[model samples]
Target chain A: MMTDLPLDQVRTLLAVVDEGTFDAAAAALHVTPSAISQRVKALEQRTGRVLLLRTKPVRPTESGEVLVRLARQVARLEHDAQAELGLSGEGEPTRVSVAVNADSLATWFLQVLTRVPEEFRLCFELRREDEDHTAALLREGTVMAAVTSSPDPVPGCSVRSLGRMRYLAVAAPKFAARHLGGPVARTLTEVPVVVFDRRDDFQDGFVRGLTRGRAGASALRHYVPTSEGFVEAVAAGLGWGLVPEPQADPLLGDGRLVGIAPGRRVDVPLYWQQWKLDSPALVQVAETVTATAAEALRP
Target chain B: MMTDLPLDQVRTLLAVVDEGTFDAAAAALHVTPSAISQRVKALEQRTGRVLLLRTKPVRPTESGEVLVRLARQVARLEHDAQAELGLSGEGEPTRVSVAVNADSLATWFLQVLTRVPEEFRLCFELRREDEDHTAALLREGTVMAAVTSSPDPVPGCSVRSLGRMRYLAVAAPKFAARHLGGPVARTLTEVPVVVFDRRDDFQDGFVRGLTRGRAGASALRHYVPTSEGFVEAVAAGLGWGLVPEPQADPLLGDGRLVGIAPGRRVDVPLYWQQWKLDSPALVQVAETVTATAAEALRP
Candidate 1:
């Protein structure tokens, strides 16, 4: 079993992955290409596993991901330590990397950022991904924290329920009159619909629930990948979709959109998952995010 | 010399890449694991190149990307042909894949979709990527068309200028008063700024231009990722940034945001590139996108 990895070798591996090639990594690190190759080779030999594929832009092997994650965590901890010791230069900001779903980012997540005190001096590196996939970034250590649909904590991390984000099925008023003339279950299965992406099954899941699992949303779907654009597309009569309550309420109130399925709503429970690290910036962000979610999301 | 590739083998390679494993590909294709293995081996033998990395979730080699692009393009052409022959099932929408930048998607691109006549019966697969990178998707055949910043066409694709997207450096009225108390160039380098993501050097590039390459944007940057969120972040006094003209207009009209750098703007020239195909759906989309862009974008 591996007990510890050499810091130089581990950091070299990360550099190669980030820079995409040994020569590039060497240039970035101000070392010779041969030195980068030697360090990577030594790391592979020490771990007894091939850590990288020698592609044009090197790709990390599954085993490499584990070590890469470790390198990032170590780097983060070192930054925290330097800041605490006052060794980090004055006014050097701490970057807090977090993955958040697009809807949350467009709505309440930005509110959390506004609430963070200026004294924290935190620079956010926000990665926008789907709620279902955000946890994968956290698991891969690409991010220190994530807003995810899953409540289960990643190994070595802690999870807390943020609250449920409610989605209401809606459409333009004219679109409802034209296409949704019959029973919602049957009409919805034939009319055009809007979806976030190919991988997004939220609208289909909503349709499936209404149809007793007999059908899904129409094949004539408009893929509007952004959360704001998705809402606008539905409002423009391109198709119907399950819009987040916050985005939907304004359009619904203004007579631009109408709730197609009254009293039926899909509530996706979101969770905050983060590495159990005692970094001050991370702690402060977690508190602000949790507090904001309490007010913004359904309990 | 390589003359032709067997369609079955090419499709099998695509399935394996998409499904991430031989076993999963086998299940998806309704074939045995052995059959999947044999087909992949046969393709490799015929091509005389290793196509896959054999990782847990399989990854394609550089040569494999070439074949994957070919497979996707072939699939697209086949779909188009089927539709032309009226052999596609009734009400089957022709799927058109195109990549667009988030800013364009958030602003004018949705209008292009709204203009498409319902008689065409098209299903759009919109991939949201940065303008700088959208051409890669077109080259990979992951998308049939793209809104890109590149004037040069991807191989086998044609390009047209879509006009320029102007960005204005702006900030919340209070943020400006607090931070921009000195010369514009000097203060911008020290104050907080908002950016789209880590890869976004637009704000930095803007500052560099202003400072005659003396500096870039401050290290105290907040990455908001989305075009809309970045604007909101700036308006909320999180940081100042270059806001796209359409998004900035309303805020600037109201007392919420003020143009910090007056009479100075960064105009990114946009282009529409598409595969040189004869598909009616693709043709119609290109025409609509180009026309809409002509009106919305700066000449």
Candidate 2:
């Protein structure tokens, strides 16, 4: 029946998660370790949900992580609000934290920073994450906004569509000639492929669309975590991949890579999802990002 | 450089926004109006950004919105942490705020709530926004997590690929027969269509795909905002519309509506984006959402 939570307890959970232990939280708050432990125990009791796992360091339980994220975001907004009211201190610039995916960072996400006006005296803590999972950072209050694939907005936020990013499946001209024989829809499953990571479904998803679940590309995998390296791996003939068309275009034109199947492309529609706050910094970032996306991505 | 903004300034901004005047902020903070104005001026000087509009009911600038959201999120986490640390009053519960889109809410988003343990004693404040913009809520620290269209996680959040939501264009058999002629790909552009709001483009995108940019859905549009209402509007013979197959299936079976074109469906790939925190509630939500989406959506 508990319908409301005090903000202080939520913040304590974040600190515990960040610092990794009740003892550390106590030190940060200049309180006794026992006090920190008691507060956490009390919080769990109220929520009837275990908010943290009391490991050596400490971890927010699935429920706890949600609250921890809430805490972090609250702190960020509070900072901005104070400065707006002109009650800021003599020293210290505020940190604007954000989480974004790798592909966008490589493409246009970084450019958002370039637009932040010189006056906000803002500091940045950029978290590199996959677009598919960046909203998790927002939930955890680890970052303010995300570049994501979902058309649905996260809880308590607003959403705007950025545009669609076009990705093409290409390979070295010689590799295609040697490996792919007939219609791409038919030969794709049997061909070798370079995968970026274990979780990567780009190659498999591409194959699935073609064969309608018949099979997938060769399992010979090259796990390059970085976007640049992933593209390079494909270019080096490690295997064919579904590369971003922008990245693949020049290579294809130069005869370095050829379309195993031309005229077919995958359009990944991207959107910018962020907290629905009225912050100058966030708006500036959004404006720049949307504008850039319009230029770089297909409308 | 202000690496970290002070918590106090942020709180003041919130007070001002909520109170809607410098004097109101002063009253809330137990300070003079002059003091309030001075604090805001000081904050603007420090950030070098104008954070607010000097209005009767103040509005935040783009930069100011960021601060508002940040303050809200920070406050949320603080409370959760306090409760977890046993710092809350004996009967206090935690409020977990989230941003979500209307469609998911009408569909399977509520299932996440079912998975929550009753003892967690949580109250949810759901914000209704577009999926494409949910991440903005996270960026503003307005909500801890969101179900968004973007795959790029919010700055500090984590993201997971939930699955794909499929939509099919359908209408009441009467409506389809009256407005759309033979071969939907050819006739759809001329048919009246149902859209959500000024921003609705699902139908337009579909038509563009069908006509290869040569045409678009009728400018004769009907705006129905709600998901259920929109489907009903189409079924009522107002217009042909793109409907999530799940919602359209029964209507089609009952002969209330018919697919303008069969076997042609659009699948919007979805992802679950949240903060990267390990809170028990957030984790539980993620698992439930992922599982539910797996069951409800096309892989």
Candidate 3:
């Protein structure tokens, strides 16, 4: 059934989705608007499913996402084949897209890029998302690889454990004296808190774990989205938060930030997930990432 | 005509868009799916425009974005009014959503949070976006305020200058000695370069400004999405890039990075743009952001 899907029609569907409008897609493909419309209609008839929502900027349906993922994967394979055959233009580097979490990117992930061999001649397109959501990017075919917190692989993707990233509940010494002098768990539920983003529930999860699920972090919270900024916000006494060990270590040593929870820590196990393709670039990245994570993250 | 638009219907449209489906919206609002559908249909009929695309995860149309922004602004005003009248529940802090660029958030924006008076009792929902695209969040009603590079205001929003953020072309001393030995402009077009993200054209724009638009930064580029990571990558000899003055200053003072282009700097004038509502919380944040930018940015 998959073999029956027309490649040109599938490619056209991807182009329309990428360009957002039929007219825009026509301009991009150097085809007439009528031709673009006919191709899309033919593809829809072939699949017996409506693929795109014909809005100002067209959006894909769930069925459409499946095809889009296929189209991207096919394109990636074609690019790899071209590079291997020396058919790609001279000096045109192969681009590898990956979705990574803020913490890893800020800490050990950048080191991966520095470690890649110069012979690879690869250009990296990184999409920074929360660790919990990076797998979604992989499922959507928006990226070829991801550093995700989930151990389970997205369908058609293989996963490997990248070890755990430990976080400490920390606050400035002055903040501890001012607001957190009481029981640590009880005080955390009332004092101001710092979070990575609205989607971040780490601090709340920490508080809930400490208080037997009776409470969460404070209602008065500051959202500092960047990993570096989150650590800085906590150290500057804006609010208490769970800071990753590598980022928190320097501040802890300098007495700029102190551990509020004496022995409690959260360890988030990360995994490297990638499409089950045999592309050399993806293979190289996966190897470098796994090697780096082994050294940077706790076993 | 504007007053004729039903508030419930507008709010329903926002709910459907946020929840991404009629059933989800129904569950979120504690209403039946039929009621959610009827309300959304009514909104479209009243507005004489399709407000949503009925995809698996629904998307708002361009006209829908305008109404969503309106709904968010109205919600903001009502929250402020309730807080002022002391009708808000005990300890329910006002949440102010603001969109800001990464560089500002990392360098000086966190300071704004620390400076806000404790009595404001605010919970911040920050969306970190590129400065060039931050105003789009305002237009989509995703944020009440934004620190944007555009001086031109989004409709229904007022704008104020936040001064200029100057950037310096910097690379590690070792990177400079290796890849950047030739004339700065010509060499920059070919060397490995670092960028904040795909949307980031600052480095290329700097190169174009120097070379009279004949060239862009480099074909071989590494994307380090975080502002701190970007600077760190440059310092780690990954690539040359334009680093914000506040971030670059310390690195330069410490000799970790050297300026590649002497006397050539890019000054991006940032602006504070927010809805023209009389919300005290928004007003306070705007004032603090402006004050901090004044001290942290170049005139």
Predictions ranked by TM-score, top down? 1, 3, 2
Candidate 3 — which residues are off by over 4 angstroms?
Answer: A1-6, A21-67, A85-87, A131-133, B1-75, B85-87, B131-133
Scored against the true structure, residue B56 in model 3 reaches a CA lDDT of 75
For residue B225, model 2's alpha carbon misses the true position, in angstroms, by 41
- What TM-score does prediction 3 earn? 0.91
TM-score of each: 0.91, 0.49, 0.91
- Per-structure clash totals for the candidates: 0, 182, 0
Ranked by lDDT, the better of candidates 2 and 3 is 3
**Per-residue CA lDDT of candidate 2, range A93-202, in tens?**
66566665556655666555445674765544555567556766766666777777777887646788988888888887777878788888777765556665556788
**Under the 3 Å rule for N, CA and C atoms, how many clashes does model 3 have?**
0
- CAPRI-style quality class for the chain A–B interface of candidate 2: incorrect
Residue-level lDDT of model 2, residues B1-299, one tens digit each, is 43477668877887898788998899889999998888777777778899898977997777887777667766767777887887977445555555656566556665554456657655444555676568666765666777766788777677888777788889888787676777787778766677766577889999998989988886656555556656766776767888987888889899998988777889887777676665666666667778888888788
- Model 1 chain A lowest lDDT segment of ten: A131-140
Tell me the DockQ of each model, to 2 decimals.
0.75, 0.01, 0.67
Which tens-of-lDDT digit does each residue in B111-156 have in candidate 3? 8887889789877877788765676678888888998888899888
The model with the greater DockQ, 1 or 3, is 1
Docking class of 3: medium
